[model samples]
Target: MFSGKLFLMFVATAMAQKDLSVDCGDDEWVTVRWRPELGFSQELDSSRALLGNCPPSRPASEDSLFFRVFLRDCGFIQQVTAGRVSYSNTLIYDPQPERAFISQPVQCVYDLSVGEEEPEETFSMEIMNPDFSGPAQSLRFRLGSSIPIRAVVEPRSRRPLRIYLESCEFATDANISRAAQVHPIIANAGCLMGSKAGNSSFLPRRRPDEMRLYLEAVWFAVGEQVFLHCVLEACAVQSLPVVRKACQFVPEHHRWVLLDDPSQSYACTCCDSSCLRTTDASVDGVSARKVLGPLVIVAEDPQGDASLDSQSSAGLSEAPVWLLVFAVVLVLMVCMSVLAVSYYLCFWRGGRLGYRPSRDLLTKY
Candidate 1:
């Protein structure tokens, strides 16, 4: 009986050593819970155990019953292969007395479904009417007219995500490159470069996952087909990062203004020069490329010239018929009088010449 009791105790010890549990079901984070054995609680140092070399986000909670850590805060290493994204880390714990370490590998796998059939399609960019009632069917626009553009991330994909326009350019083709004739509209991570000379701007956002850009219709060449290519990024952070901004150049003020937060216009001062990029890789974000258009900007109607031509034609028709006839007859009479005077002079000169010829003949005889 005594030997049996000792064997049961040994089995219980082995089970307690394997009590580490990791849950990767969370969308944004993985939860790690560690329960210490009955008497080893005081001997185990939770601080010594780490997730991917990152420490616990906070002290042990729930009356210290378990050590809880999040994958996002702990900086889990990410890997992508074969259209799959995986986050992985290991929890290692060492009890001071035993001098032996306990190891547990934790990982979370996410399938990348960028296929068109996927229901959780996240990102889209579209041109809308200025009022945003529906998609804009009129690709033809007039110069100085406002073109409303919107970029959106679906609500089902992720939460607490914000969208931003990283860079945008106008090109003649859908395939954009530096070698092509492209006009940079928005650059430096969302600064509206087109706003400097035009009235382009980023409209106030109505939602966190959506961004609206009001680009003024201006082009390098009139009647040329132009396409807008832009890079859209989604950030999971609650607030806008320093590098990500929606800046508009206010021609009236001669300064750049931040559309995300007008009070923090200081962040937009670099728009005139250059905006720095953020080196923080821990920020969860993804980018997508989008192209819109074959938009044509037409010149405004030449009403002034058209009206002048119409008036000149109408004036001639409006003149009295009798007055026109009288003018024509007057011109004809002037021509007839001049022709008769020339005829009489020619006849008299010929007669004089004949008389001089006869006088010469008589003198010779």
Candidate 2:
């Protein structure tokens, strides 16, 4: 009988808990509303709630607590189960140690095939020289040469868009299949994995439509035809949240900087660790996969260049000797011919004079 009374009290207290609703309506922000009994605002600790690591928006109405959290913000976590992606976070309404009241966990799921279908020509990736003026003329490059790769998103509408490279991999084949070997250059949501040894990073944005990745050609895949495969996000510039970022490690300072906005460098701190990966099929944005290929990293061969120079030098040196020999032979041949002609002319003139004198004496007799 005593247990029955306790169960009734438990049910009563549970019924008295405030009503809350989590709204994952759009891609950028999650809106959470908690409706409490009138005059109960004093009982809630707004800061203790972790809808996003940010504070809640001003109360639109006096009876409800309103929160506007960016999807990438707060302590929201993402999980992938059986190929489906979802993000979840908990909201604590009451912060009291023992008497805390927490809202039901909020989750936003996105189907991989739900986003806008990207056109074939909408996204492209190409390798460029250091100047980035045009695509690299040749795929062969010596180790340590600067290889600038650009990923572009041509606008389909007047709405301004921003492109961010989420990850990139180097592989031998254009299509990076699961069986194919791949080296991740940029992964974990923009961490430059190659920066530990070389300067590989996403460059600061010159325009919102295109993003450039600066990679130093390394001997990692020398003598092999390598390709770059990248996964990028195209988001509406107007509704962009703090989540859209490109980061690179600065070796000089041993730190990371956000290429798009250095003032928000704190966002890049996650490069040292792991950054949350979120995939959403929203009308505001879409993800694209692009490939740039057939790049050959040629090992520098100083001996080969030296051998060519030596061969040219030897040919030049032998040419002068052959010309000298030919000039000497020609001079001797010309002197011999002149001497033979002079002997023939002198002999003919002597014979003619003797014959003329004999004929004149016989005629006179």
Candidate 3:
């Protein structure tokens, strides 16, 4: 018997036929909950200070600490949020549920600071393609080929605020310490549009409110992790919390993101040789077919021997020896053929030497 608040809206956009009512799943919303006593308090803290931690450091500078926002495939995050939506979403109740609903996107914010007002926060999270996936999600990429890395950033600010796109794990700089220092990556606070789709007509940032990133993948990234970090350099909190010694009205609405783990990001694995994606199918569930990244596939041992991978490596090393032996045998055959030709032309055919074939069969030298 768990009950909380339910608020639904009707969203009609330029692309809508008339009016669209989204079935906001009772279980799907957004918040932070990992404890018993502090769970409620932490949720309140996150909701209250949604954009409060935007450090006052330079937006694209090396001094800023990237805030860690663990974003997974949209399906996974939506599923988890959906399940918890009905648990406890009743801070300020909405009076309208019978009215037409609107498309509700989870509020997104950037941690942008320009100076010493805010502390540097590491924003670590992975950007995996959407799919019905398990704990691990990885995109298969060839060694020399490239893959697109994109991220959708939606600001939680009420008004248009200046934010900066920082560094991603795919940065090419050899001396990069933070994820925001890469030059080729999108940066600055120019494409400032109200959190709406109709404001921009660009390809990457087609949705005005959302910005899509194109991170370049490198050959060395054959086996590594990828993460994206964005900072809200515009301002801290739209409604800064204070000592309400007297009275205060209900604050602005915001989404409390479930901070994700950096290690949970997809792990890249390079395939030097072609491998059959063999796995145990006896067990049930998604693990039967696919799994998270950092996947390991071992080659079958030859002759059904004990060693699997070690024997395969030893075989590669022994290839040169086999080649050397074949080369030596070929050289000996060529030398014997040359000797026979010379003997026939100079000794037997030219009348200098005579042939002895039957005598060799009867005698030993």
Candidate 4:
């Protein structure tokens, strides 16, 4: 009976150890997923293995264990397992500095034990040169982790000449879409330059002799969807002499600025107040008319145009003073003519009845 009890105890312990489970947190969490082949390589005081994965378990005093995090889309591998992960540390295959861009390989070393019941700890990784060149991308965390992380990438701000072409011509849906796609994309991506000038009261209102244009490209990435907003502006023109002097030496060529946002997962909104300007123009012999490019006005429905026409007709319903006067005069002239005809008929009937002028002739006969 004593032998049987000892055997039962051993079986229970084995079962409990085999029943390990790991919760990788939630869907919104960001994690680095690793492949089995690329194991971590760093010196660790204690081995901290992911709770429910292969490689079974590491020794308690192994100092360090190997683990790997593979970025499927970015084609990079990050080795993170239990040691100091700093920005100064270089990634094996990455040429850019650490933290320069998202999805780049990263390594983190932490002091923890594989036998620890709970695996919960916060780690900080510094990203150097956050501005990276590449297509827009995102990082999704694996399950069983806590602590949410949010990232936003803004384009480097620059002073560029921005011009907003406003006109009424882009009233159609097709036109608006075309203009939105063509004008902003091409112009914003094109080359341009700009400079800031101090405020001046006597600055010339006339057009400049030479203008430099700068283009800014904005990318709005909300989840899987992405949209672009482009801004074109003139730069290098300033009202202050000092600013002008400084700007004079800078190149007048166009520059492109790119921005990225990941929180907006579906639709992209480009609300740039700088691009709103009077779209009307008056050219030689022609009167000022609203210029509508290919872009349609998104603020109102197509039916609104008919409503505007109705309102215009309503405004014209009020007759002018001269028109009213002419109408009154016409009525008066018709009434006068009718009265004169009645008076003439009465006189003619009375003369016939009286027969006075013929009486002297009858007396002579």
Candidate 5:
């Protein structure tokens, strides 16, 4: 009798626990994203799946993040046996760091269905140069500034890549002169000079990957125009030969900086305010605009701070009042000359037969 009673009790408990609708995954409990494309399909082939065919015991992925406590909530976790009705499952996975696999706790539920897969992936590479207003996509630096160069490769391809930043002046004449030196890769990778003032090569100090490579400061003289060009190239690796084919990038003339040696008199021609990077408080230097070609040094006048040359603003404030007067007088003289010519041509009486008296054409009264 005792054994029979125990069997009956077990059957009743399972019936009570069969209320799975209350235990379903929802936004309140777990992060949920409906994957419509994954409908009617088991995510893990009944073996690697997180739900159906799971082991009797659950192992924690990291720091014992698995759940053991049962709470009174909606939607019971149901193991899929078979059926298209159980389609449009929810997919949940921990977003991992670069080149890392998702933990085993990735969750999928039959809550949502997407007709299509996620949007097509896009690849991009960019140098976070200093942004100082306007369209020029430039980097502003002081003479002794060492900006940390970094690149972000999305969708985490295991392919190895390298970034190059070199002093490149991409003029048609320069391209012809250094045609042999120009690497078919970068606009002129082979022609990469150290700095405008001539210094060490701009190669990364160590083997650099996706991580930010903190380089030693290569000091350039103030007012030197540095046109830094960058190229993203994929390097072949023994482990991933196919990645080389999938990964292809091009050179971009991304950064143009006109370095400001604080000792130089005139403020930056393009930069409006002091520039700053994320960790620039400990580093010295302010933001400035990039000037192209030879640096124009403007001597500061004692009367005012201005550039010395035509490009500079030295003569703007120092303009004599007499010059304004002279300009007005010149404009008046031109206008008077135009008026005199118009009057003479319109009213002058030099006809083909000479001036005829008005009375000759007048009707007798």
Candidate 6:
């Protein structure tokens, strides 16, 4: 009975061991296991930096490495209908190649119709890192609906490489009503806002219209991997009234932009009083003053010399046309005289000038 109990204990230990182990490249790779009570935790060994082979004196088991945890779609709404909301958590990792290693998925459903009562069921999971020898890992989460979801990293490193959240692709149609509030949070966190909306005004105009918020982050490295966090909130704005305001980023030099929907457009104009004006003459209800400058001087083409003024000036400044005609006639007269002299010498005086008569002429005589 004692031996049997020992064997059973060993079997339980083996089963528990199976649940935790580092999933290295190979099947036997050591995995660290955690109980549900541990929640989220991570540790890194400062001496064993992963950058170069500055080998640590510790054994392979003691070697520590830094790692990042990415919860894909951690906070997201899968579906919404009739005051019911459903969401699921997706795990993402920077060091761990497998998504399953992080934690099993948890799903939560909420029904607002329950009237301020607690959710009927809440699903949750804890994330933890057993290794304590590497750099601190970064964590990112999105709150509210406005984009670029806000992110926070623990034990912020001085001049630490900026970590990015990647994976989530923002859709233009996704809820952004929550995005406006979220932008202020992200800006306060020292991160630049990336946008799928080509124009900034595409962001929610009214504080309430902002709803859908998708978030991802990237390390400051120009082309580093970005981890996607979660879609925060999604809401409908189809019933909201369209609001038009001049886009704040539009340049002062540009003419008034034609807006198909006046309620949806806003003008961002220069502060100068003369820079912007609205006139009833415009097809749209707005018109701007036409800014005029000096006329540009264009160089005349040298080949276009056909002006009467040029012709008259050139005639008075140079030789007359009649002199040129007389010179040409005199040269023709000299050429004709020389030709007549040569012809007379060659044929008219052949007998007297020691030129022989042809035999044909002698036979004819």
Best by TM-score: 2
Cα lDDT tens digits for candidate 3, 1-365: 01222233321122132221112332222232111122232221222111111211112122111222222111111111323211111111111345221112233222212331222222222333432122224354433222333333333334332122321223322222222222222211112111111121112334322333322333333334333222321222222221000111111322111012112111101111211122122211100001123311122212234355557878856566779899999999999999998888777775455644667676875
The whole-model lDDT of each prediction reads: 0.64, 0.63, 0.26, 0.23, 0.27, 0.27
* Segments in model 1 whose C-alpha atoms lie over 4 Å from true places: 1-81, 84-121, 301-365
Displacement of residue 285 (Cα, Å) in model 4 is 45
Residue range 1-365, candidate 2, lDDT tens digits: 00011111111112234576655543445677765432344555455443423346763365466876655444355444443445565544544656535554566664434343323226777888778999887777778877888888887777777887777777777644321346777765666777766877677678888888778787667788888777666777743346666778888878888777777788778877767655434435545566777777778852456677888988855566778999999999999999877776667656332334468777897
Question: Residue-pair clashes per candidate, as listed?
Answer: 0, 2, 34, 48, 22, 50
What lDDT score is found at residue 52 in candidate 3? 16
lDDT of candidate 6 over 119-192, digit per residue (tens): 22111111111132222132221122122222222212222111122112221212322111112211101111
Alpha-carbon RMSD of each model: 20.1, 20.7, 23.0, 25.2, 24.7, 26.1
Each prediction's TM-score versus the true structure: 0.50, 0.51, 0.25, 0.21, 0.21, 0.21
- Which is better, 2 or 5, measured by TM-score? 2
The TM-score of candidate 4 is: 0.21
Stretches of candidate 6 off by over 4 Å are 1-73, 78-84, 93-103, 111-192, 195-365
Worst lDDT run of 10 residues, candidate 5, spans 1-10
Candidate 5 lDDT by residue in tens digits, 1-365: 00010111111111223211122232112221111122243242212212211121244332222332111111122222221111112122222224222222222333222342221212233334433122223344433344434533333445443322211222111212211111121112112233323322232224433323222223332333333223232232232211111111112322222221222212211122221112111221111111122211122221233234543654557787899999999999999999887766666754333456578557655
Instruction: Please give the range of 10 consecutive residues that has the lowest summed lDDT in model 6.
Output: 1-10
Q: Residue by residue across 39-117, what tens digits does model 4's lDDT show?
A: 2663332222231111113342333233221111111112223431111111121113342211112322222233422
Identify the runs in model 5 with alpha carbons over 4 angstroms from their true place.
1-138, 155-192, 195-208, 211-227, 238-365
